[model samples]
Target: MNAEQHESGSWYWEVGSEQCPHGPEPDYDTQPEAWDIWIDRHTGSPQDVRICLDAPAGEACLQCSEDDGEMVPWESCRIREHARPKQGVVPNPGAEHQPVTVLVGTLECLDRECDEYFGDDGDEIPDMESCSHIREEQACSCQRQDDGEYSNDPCPARSLSVTGGTA
Candidate 1:
């Protein structure tokens, strides 16, 4: 199954496979049965290559009709819808070109009993990483290894991802 199809139906290339699910070693009479052919706009022009596109859906697909250029798995080969963009027209901005989602993880102590979590006098400690008391006094086994050497794990803080405004 294509992982990108769910994100966006737009495709960079149409991929097909014919490998068998039940394989007692399926017979391969040919050397390499599968192929991956991506849209190379530089190879053909709009006039020479008939191109169609679903502009609203932002979907563009191509197939080899006149010539045998479409790549398909040997077993199930069929002519798929062929689409190309007009010359000087930009291709679909596929799922890969969509805006990025950035998740920033921040650390904070979840244990209410830990003094440094809030602070000794009830004023919240600004930085838990700087709160050395937690490493010595609290249940932060991640601070050091059993042999007493410094551990690779960061401070035993509960990581939280928060947006600027409440959802």
Candidate 2:
């Protein structure tokens, strides 16, 4: 997804951002094609045919000067990890069923109806700077990239969690 590849092969990967003497260096871009191949071969998820990073406007990095460019977690925009029902996957009629892991996130709403949250036409808007007062950080029950473990209130932040499912 990197429109500008700095080196022969650099897609930023785990090296998200680093603090240097010249302030935070721009997060480097990394190879995304490798992920498509890896997901398909390892997970056998038919990634090329079914998987994609869905970026809602609220989650996009609008700070970049270029309006038209590839999106891949460049500045404040972190392509959040999420999933949806895969299409074209035929279910096995005879396979035993079990509970599945379902992750739920939180959305902080205004204490009361705020006019700023709506557009001029009366429709609800998304990620407008005017509506920032109504937005809230997702309660932190996020996974730790370093340890790969789920945390509930890990440190100063932790969101709710759903149990009974194996990942």
My TM-score estimates for the predictions, one after another, are: 0.13, 0.16
Sequence-dependent TM-score of model 1: 0.13
**lDDT of each residue in 30-118, candidate 1, tens digit only:** 42232111222212332353222211223333222113443323111122211112124332344322212111111222122345567
Task: Please report the candidate that would top TM-score against the real structure.
Answer: 2
Whole-model lDDT per candidate: 0.28, 0.30
Q: Give, for candidate 2, the lowest lDDT window spanning 10 residues.
A: 7-16
List, residue by residue over 35-111, the lDDT tens digit for candidate 2: 55434322111112221122122223332312334333332222222221122332244533322232322112222
RMSD each, Å: 24.9, 18.5
Clashing pairs in 2: 10-29, 10-30, 11-29, 11-30, 11-31, 12-29, 12-30, 140-159, 141-159, 153-158
Q: Which regions in candidate 1 have their CA more than 4 angstroms from the true location?
A: 1-113, 130-167
Return the lDDT, model 1, position 88.
42
